[model samples]
Target: MLKRIGYTAGGFVLIGVLAVAILWGLSVGTVQFSLSQIFNIVMDQFSSPLAIDDPLNGPEQTIIWLLRMPRLLMAAIIGAGLAVSGVIMQAIVKNPLADPYILGISSGASLGATVAILFGIGVMFGENFVGIMAFIGAMAISFGVLFISNLGGRPNSVKLILGGLALSAVCSSFSSFVVYLADDKEGIQTITYWLMGSFAGAKWDMLPFIAVVVLVSIIFFWSQSRILNMMLLGDEVAITLGRDLHTYRQVYLIISSLIIGFVVYAAGMIGFVGLLIPHLVRMTIGTNHWTLIPFSALGGSIFLVIADGLCRCIIPHAELPIGILISLIGAPTFVYMLVRKNYGFGGE
Candidate 1:
């Protein structure tokens, strides 16, 4: 009972933190707003039709509602999706080092974005052409990895990882080739920034698709927690228990691909959240998927929200790319986890 209560309490705390982080994120950047002001602005949306037209500052309202809200929400959603993807990938391959991009999704997205940004392939999508191309790239590579891994025989964990790595190299080489051929210096600079990741392009129009993909994937994966736990026991053990994870693994890959592709479309390539959040949650809550999934989702959201907030304020007059900020913060934290032998990563 106490353990259950503790878990429940922890969940509430995380939700509270997420709420605060959202408001804090809104308060950052050049124009700042207090929590009360942010609250009033948000509440005004729910007010009666007779509500005054100018309840809050005009530019501030635009900044908070139109800009920061979507961006921060995207960060939270992507973070949650990536963390859950990491959890599933780690379980499927039985490898602690696995991450959401272990299947070459990131490379594919990068390649697609490179093509669109440099070659103008999907410029028809206007503002979202790069993101659309990235989604195409990610989905293609994910399915390609699965197909190649199964070509020799029944796909196994080893083949999947190897296939992903091989295709990732191919995609990276192609991206490099495209970049090398491009003579547009400013376009190259744009590609560099996009590769590092940013949420500056986030808008309400993109939220519906991204939210649906991430939320649906999260719900579906969380429902499969029992099987995921069994997967950690190895195929032999899982088979003994009458659960063949081979087919399920492929389905998961597709779902993860969808979630990851949407994230790439929205936020470029923010890393480490997926790789780091699951391990952190596992360290505190043990390996039970019931607890692991929800905690990891919330924790991932918090991590990204805080990271995004830092990116906005860390510089004097400019915002840092969120991907770079996460790398700067996550690398040291990851090293610390590696050095401290206490976490065990399920081996101990």
Candidate 2:
């Protein structure tokens, strides 16, 4: 117990240090704001409704609030949502490698967004309709994966994985066909960018819905830590322990699909944080989700905030696509982890 507590504390502190680094990066961006100015903007946000203020507090306030702040928030929320869904999907399927993006939810969502943009569908919901359709597409893929795997018998972890890969290929091909057919130069450009992902679209209107969904799911999953721990032990073992993980796994996949749907709608296809962060947390905190889930969620949020900050400041006038950044970093790290083989979040 003491060891678990210690690991959790260490993870939280490490993440806190990373958070400070992220804030420093934000204040040091191309549009520089002094640390004091950044502090003042944060204080002002709490003290008043409008950022409408004195001229001396001008560009600093704008830089801190208008640009960097929303991006940071989106990064954090998307990170938490991905990590949380990763935890749930891993528990549900009893696989160390399961991630929403890997399991085809993201591909399905990309297809939905492409359809919405090209065909002029879902217009009534205005700007948000694309996200809604993406959510629908994601859930459809999730069920498709589940049902297809269950065709012969109860889905083992291997079968679930196989199903996800096949469905993901189908979705990707369909999306590619749509892009090919459109032949609209701007539309193709938009689709290409969306596939790479960005938090540059962050806005105040977008915050509440995603935040609440992520937070509520985090709380819900935190309470199920024991069940998740059992899930990792495999199906027969879980059954012996008197839990029917079949229904439970389905429930978790559905909930994760909902979260992933919303996240994909908002953030596009930022990948690997889900796969990488949980394993990193598990390496430090062990497989116990009680500590692991919450810490992983916090760690993920911190990671993305820092990553998003890096994406913003790395160039003078342009932003790096976050999906590319995560893949670039995550792939090397994943290879290192696989080669090292000492950390052991169940990878063989």
Candidate 3:
């Protein structure tokens, strides 16, 4: 028990260090900021400037405040959203190989974004339309998977995966079809970037909505961690405890889908945090979602912030897509965990 507390405390410190590192990453970019300038921006508010009209400003302030800060904040949200959702999904399915994206949420959201961008289906919503469509698309895929799997019988993980795969394939094919037919070069380019994933589109306006949704969902799931642990025990054992999980399972899926919808809208499907962070937490803390959920959320934010920072600094004048950077580092880390620990979602 004491050891568990140590791990939790250690986890918090680790998160802090990562947060600082990410801020440093935000500062040292194409237009670098000295520690003092960075400090000033952090301290300054609507009240007054950090210094008495410090001349050492302008583009640096604009770059830090307007560009990098929002991007990094979005990364934190996406990372935490994906990781927490991944933890929830893995728990629900009792599968070690589960991630929010693995169940086709990302693909579904992508398809929705593509349709809106290409056909302007939800353009009536104006600037917010694209995100609204993506949310609808995520819910669509989730329901499709649930409906298909339940038609035959209980949705064991196998049926769930297969259902997600079929729906994802259909969505991807349709998106491709639309792109193929569209003559607009600009539309095609928009789809391409949307597919790759980014925080470059991050705006203060959108971040608040995303933050509230993600934070609220995290709190909601954190309360259910005890039940989540039962999920890993499989349906048979769960029934023995007088709690059949079919209803709760669906509840988690829908809630996580909402979170994923927001993340996909904000970041365009930054992968790895969902897949990698939970695995790491499970490796360190075991399958207990009580600890896993919050820990994974913090870890995911740190991971993404650092990754985004790398994206900014890696190329002198340009940025790498956060999605690709996550894959580059996260995939190998996952492989190593799978090979070494061979942990089986705490089931085996």
Candidate 4:
């Protein structure tokens, strides 16, 4: 009971931190707003219909509700999705080093974005053709990985990892080839920036779809916590217990692929969150997926919200790309975790 209470307290603390981070994200940026002003603006949304048009702070309301809120929400959603996906990937492959992009999803998305941006492919899909094509590419590569892995025998962890790596290499080569052939300098710069990642394009219109997808995926994975735990014990143990885990692994991969695809479509290629956030949660809480999933979700949201806020104000009149900033932080933090003798990545 005491342990449960402790976990509950930790959860509340994480949620509190996430809430504060959201508020901070709203208040930062070029046109800053005081906390009180932010409060009034938020309250105005729930005020009487007559007062709706006349906000407490009109300009601030527009800035917060229209611009910052959507971006911050996207950050939170993407962060949660990536973190949960990481947990699932690690469990699926039973490898501590595995991440959401281990299946070449990133490479596929990059290739799709590269094609759409440079060659104008998928333009018929609409204004967001780049993201759409990227999603398609990600899904295609995920299926391709599965197909390759299933060749000649039932797919296993080793086969899956090898398949992913091979497809990743192939997709990367194709993306590079496209870049080499395309002479559009502006397009190349756009690809570079998109690959680096940013929430600058986040809007209210795109949030609903991405948020629903991510939320549903997280819930699904959390529901399968028991099976995920068994996966760590290997196929032999799982079979002895009458749980195959083969189908479960594939299903998890497909679901995680959806999460990654939409994430890439919405926010470009933000890395390190999927790789770092799960491990951080594991280090804090025990590796039980029941605890790990929710905690990792909250932790990821907090990290990205704070990161996005810093990105807005880290330099005057210029916003930093979120992916670059996260990599800068994640790389060093990960190294520290690696060197720590006590941190056995949940193996101990």
Q: What is the C-alpha lDDT of each candidate?
A: 0.87, 0.81, 0.82, 0.91
lDDT of 3 by residue, 29-134 (tens): 6788888887777666334643324565577666777678878888888888999999988887778778897778877898898889988999887886887788
- Tens digits of per-residue lDDT for model 4 on 2-59? 9999999999998899999999999999999999988987786667322324545467
- Stretches > 4 Å off in candidate 2: 4-8, 11-15, 51-57, 346-348
TM of each candidate vs. truth: 0.95, 0.92, 0.92, 0.96
How would you encode candidate 1's per-residue C-alpha lDDT over 140-226 as one tens digit per residue?
Answer: 999999999889788878889999999999999999999889988998999999988988888877888888888888888889999
Candidate maximizing TM-score: 4
- Which segments of candidate 3 are over 4 A away from where they belong? 49-57, 346-348
Each model's total of backbone clashes: 0, 0, 0, 0
Q: Global CA lDDT of candidate 1, please?
A: 0.87
Clashing pairs in 2: none
User: On a 0 to 1 TM-score scale, where does candidate 1 land against the true structure?
Assistant: 0.95
Worst 10 residues of 3 by lDDT: 45-54
Q: What is the RMSD of candidate 3?
A: 3.0
> Cα lDDT for residue 293, model 1?
90
Off by over 4 Å in 1: 48-57, 342-344
lDDT, ranked from best to worst? 4, 1, 3, 2
